[model samples]
Target chain A: MSARPQVDPRGPRFAAWVTSAVLVAVLLTGWWPLLAAQVVVFAVGAFASLSAAPYSVLYRVLVAPRLGPTDEREDVAPLRFAQGVGFAFALVGTLGYAFGVPALGVVATAFALAAAFLNAAFGLCLGCETYLLLHRLPGSTRTVSDH
Target chain B: MTGALVALGTLLVAAVVGFALRARDGRVRAREDDTAARVPAEVRAALDAGARVTLVQLSTTFCAPCRQTRVLLSDLAARTDGLAHADVDLTDRPELAKALSVLRTPTTLAVDSRGVELLRVGGVPKRENLLAALAPHLPG
Candidate 1:
């Protein structure tokens, strides 16, 4: 079996950033339906992250085997962080819904969708990139490198 | 119904997002000119020896779909007789990627024993497709 290539971590990072931003926006906007939408989106993203390996396996069998080996530890950390943040955002949206925030969730959900769009469109992956960049900084670098 | 609608909407959004990304960044086109001659003489010999099926998967690291495909093919190879699956990583070999015209991760190719191409699948192939593809070659 040949070794797989290294894919840029940008995509997942961007996804994380989008998820975070959307959650924040929904909290402020008070759009219940939209907020609900964002929550589902975040969950799907989380699920995708969790079930990543199986999907990769499927790709290898059906598609081209030109894939690179990934740094799983590096990849999983951002995904977990995103998942946590997304869940929190969902909780907030639910509360806002109960309190009659009146479309605050919807607006926030739109923002999240926008963020997701940005990540996918521009390959911005800001969250992951930020983590990686910060991780490379002095103390963090040492910790990551050591591990 | 609401949940299903939400799921469909999300998929549509994802598709549009993916398409926009592709448009902005341009699709990664595999170069078809550089065929790797790295197939060892022994491997070629094995391929020539009535192996009948060559499963070539093109994949990249960090691609979730690629890994899933690999497991499926391995399982299939193990369960089936006389069908051989060779996973070729395209990351290190741009030449092979080009030669095979691989555009996306996890492109699978079904080849004959002599290395002649039979059918090609650009994404994760369904089990039914694989079974149907192999039916003609399977021992009756």
Candidate 2:
């Protein structure tokens, strides 16, 4: 019944692994530029189509081909929301590093890395969990109130 | 040296959290306080349809594992007599989630025909574990 386009579930996990690596690099080097680049990637995936994001492109062009095919497809909304969460952390980390606040930068990137690594390693999507928990919060604009 | 330590610390923390989650996920915990709790009308309706036990799955739209759980539960229900599967979307039903104290998706509640909560699983349940847990309540 859903008209939304579904994506290969593997694509997001692959992207998460790449994101974890990028976050690790950013953390190790205190590189604002690299973190900035990752922020852009997350922004694209969050605001635009997830398939158009850099890692997704890599997944389609390089990784997915080798894995043959997967019948398991996932909705894009949660993944995009997760990308938005990544963008928030990456942006904060970039700002912290660019502004000479290394502590803030380290903390933010570490959090992002933690989330990305969980998705990569255990298929646990914290951002997706956040989305669900957010909906359950009171006064959150949910239309249905009966039953 | 500090950077390496930070990175290592981050990985270690994530690993610990992941392990903890993996251990708890899909575990069915019987609710001792659910002896007097009645299921919602939706689930009670399934019981009225002659099902001895109904597996009520609470799922959200964006939950990928929920799709797999749906497949597993529906198949289980189809092959088993007196067992029904009802998937309730929590996307529009925050009140229901609150009423049931369900904070996560792919949560399965095993309810008897009288609407008592037999047991509940928080994540994607292992097939054998679920079957074993429901064995006493099921006919065969």
Candidate 3:
């Protein structure tokens, strides 16, 4: 009997690139404040994805080694969620900047940069941790650790 | 104006706090194992013939420490002479991780000029420690 080939289907690596392209498109639309916001948002998203090398390493070194084949599915949701948030932030920042709320966009960009630096230097994910804590509030049964 | 500035300041402060907390946790759980493993005969031979330093970094998804280690290793490789670094994402290749027997994120294996394994560092290695480890194998 012929052995079946193993197909690993986890989160898509091109998610960041797609989001970046969208942000660039929005920026090119010629909306002043929105374009500025998009810039900040895109910058944050890029840094977050690139700076997240530590978390990727941890998953490889600690989790994957122990979990085996099935663990691949476990990684998909979290990655997608993180990437989606990045896209959303960029979109919102663009909208805000377009509406003349550049400060909000700047804040978002700063937060993104800080998150990236933190993960790069110390191995921490403020967004993930915050998501977890929010999920733990009364009436919410889903824990951040579930991801 | 003040409100926006305050908000920005707050975000920066939160980032600093988050960074500090993670760093503290990282220091507490940092690994101390540093035994060099035997290199393959061919790899050793390549190193002895003046091959560049080979840096292998093992990492995982959702790991903060792994990211820091990658940056540090990349920076180290760039600054040092005849050093090259490659990172392996354990999430993408479970089999490779198994073959390498990686137990932690940020595990670094340094191969010297003789292609022999010179040192293995688990966790974030101090800049000085990494430099010192490579000093012996560097060409005089």
* Clash tally, candidates in order: 60, 0, 25
- Cand. 1 TM to true fold: 0.43
* Best model number under lDDT: 2
| Each candidate's interface RMSD | 10.5, 2.0, 9.7
Please identify model 3 stretches exceeding 4 Å from their true place.
Answer: A1-147, B1-50, B113-115
Ranking by DockQ: 2, 3, 1
- Which tens-of-lDDT digit does each residue in A1-147 have in candidate 3? 114211122212322333333333433343445445444443343344522433343455555576557522222333433443454455555556667786665454444444444433333444443342333346442322233
Task: Give Cα-based local distance difference scores for all models.
Answer: 0.50, 0.83, 0.49
Q: What TM-score is obtained for chain B in each of the predicted models? A: 0.65, 0.88, 0.59
Sort the candidates on TM-score, descending order. Answer: 2, 1, 3
- In model 3, the Cα lDDT at residue A70 comes to 52
Provide the lDDT at A4 for model 3.
21
Candidate 1 residue runs with Cα over 4 Å from true position = A1-147, B1-50
Q: Model 2 over residues A28-101: C-alpha lDDT tens digits?
A: 88879999999999989988788899999999999988998877778886788778778888888999999999
C-alpha-based local distance difference test score of model 1: 0.50
Error of 3 at A136 (Å): 28
Question: Which candidate achieves the best DockQ against the true structure?
Answer: 2
Q: How well is each residue in B1-140 modelled by candidate 1, as lDDT tens digits? A: 33334434554665576565445331212223345233333334435255667666665432345665777877887787777777765544545555555555566766667565666665456766677767786666
The true-versus-predicted C-alpha distance at residue A17 of model 2, in Å, is: 1.2
